[model samples]
Target: MMLRPFSKSGSFYKGNLHGHSSNSDGKFSVSEVIDAYKKRGYDFTCISDHLWIDNRFCAETVTDASKYNTHNFIAINSAELHTRGKKYDKENLWHLVANGLSKDFKPSNDEENIQDLIKRAKGDGAFISIAHPEWYSLTFDEAIMLKDCHSVEIYNHASTVKCNRGSGIYIADFLLNENVKTLLTSTDDSHSLEEDAYGGWVFVKTKELNEKKILKSLIKGDYYSSTGVVIYEVKLEKRLLKLKFSSSNNIMVSGAGHTNISSHGYNLTNAELDLENFDSPFFRITISNQFGKYAWTNPYWFNELDLD
Candidate 1:
């Protein structure tokens, strides 16, 4: 089935996958978050509350999935699996976003204990992502070892809340170490209602929007992370990664996904890199500013044979 074509006229859908509501610590209710994005011309959103996998709230809010699940606007359900944190009392939350899994899905913040939960969620065909690696001990070294992790968050809304120290800097650095295929996502880990924390989000390029198709695009890594900026398109070919910006502003793109990849400064509105390209497995991208603050895109895996 052909999904609704992405905004071909350069319009992009904005979504926050790691949002919280009164259900957790967020100030707004689910309805409030939806209304907020709708006002900003968002196509859809995922209410990935903390520690809960049940989307019954989503179903209840929309009432009719068919009507709301259209080309323009839709609501999806997801959860943020918690993990051990640096402090003994505070839990290190590792998010595992799932789609049609059983509502019984549970998240733990017990350091490595969340591994078992992630394995089970992936086994049941859920879309799982490692939350902010810059938070606790959830480093890229650990994420690389975890199997079936379809994606990782390059930037988190709450990252700034953690003194901007939780932005997945080290994770992006390690992406250059080995070729690991995984999608990258950005979420507004919102806990307050007064602020627009949904600053970081993904710009997906699918023609249609639905639970199935949206999740599929995410798993395939056909999305880009953004913070007040949008990547119109990204294509990696013949040891080159080409990126087009939606707006022509002085932008910076830097990150080490694979080894031996070096980048030249921006040539007008585009950035070019001769990074060691991977034909198969995952490759990563980082876009940022001179200030060292930026967003990370999930590794877009290239099939060995498809790299022609």
Candidate 2:
């Protein structure tokens, strides 16, 4: 059986699932952001401006950049939602990114917690992600509380270059170890404050380049997050896993605590691993090139694929 992303049928659409604009604290306006992303060769982009009450860095309304949609490039309505009651945040706020949201999505008041916020966003037809967990120091308790969300922000480029804590690898693995069944995401979270835009993104597969279809594909784990590497395909048969991709210095399979298998070579474009006795309920793949760019696949469980 082919792993999903590969199992799904569609053209791959390159996109940034998280970003900011002048509607929030970002430097550029919606149109400027659109022009910038299109110039970078993105098929679609989300203007996920901050949706909170803090006027200094947030707006109460979601950003709707749909007017800039053309025959090829388009914008998805989105917001970087926030709420209160967290252990380690400086502002005690939880950062959640919601893509394909309706413009009327409400802002969180002081009383709303993360769970309530997630439920409301999902009910409103949005794909939600736990944003920048490593950058914000989200606690294990906080991650558990949000175990039901669609995905974890596994990589955030803005936080990486700006603060050096752009990876949520631990939290994502921890959630999987806990059997949370969550997906993974990579985002720029760009404010255009520095050289942050286009540094990270997700390549989603869908038949149409519209918001509804993209959101549906995202929720189904029909995409791969990347810093630079591109994965062509993934397939499994008779306990052997095969992957095709661009040149990479390292390719590895990561699983439950301390369980990892790897193969390394120069300009290696393909590799296969025998998982016949690999000791883990779930597995994920990682590829990194010489320039330090990485690509990650969402965890797939053995039982879910009827292989366990």
How do the residues 144-171 of candidate 2 rate in per-residue lDDT, one tens digit apiece? Answer: 9998789999999999999999999999
Looking at model 1, residue 74 earns an lDDT score of: 82
Give the alpha carbon lDDT tens digit for every residue of 1-308 in model 1: 11112223333456667666666556777787777777777777766665633344222121111234555688766665544432322432345555434455544433355567777777766677767776555654466655366666667777666566456656644653455555567777766645547577877656567667666666665566777555555665565667664433244334343333434343234666664633335455555554344445554444532554
- The best candidate by TM-score is 2
Alpha carbon deviation, residue 126, candidate 2 (Å)? 0.9
Give the distance in Å from residue 186's predicted Cα in candidate 2 to where it truly belongs: 0.4
Tell me the spans in candidate 2 whose CA falls farther than 4 Å from its real position.
306-308
Residue pairs clashing in model 2 are none
| Residue 102 displacement in candidate 1 (angstroms) | 4.6
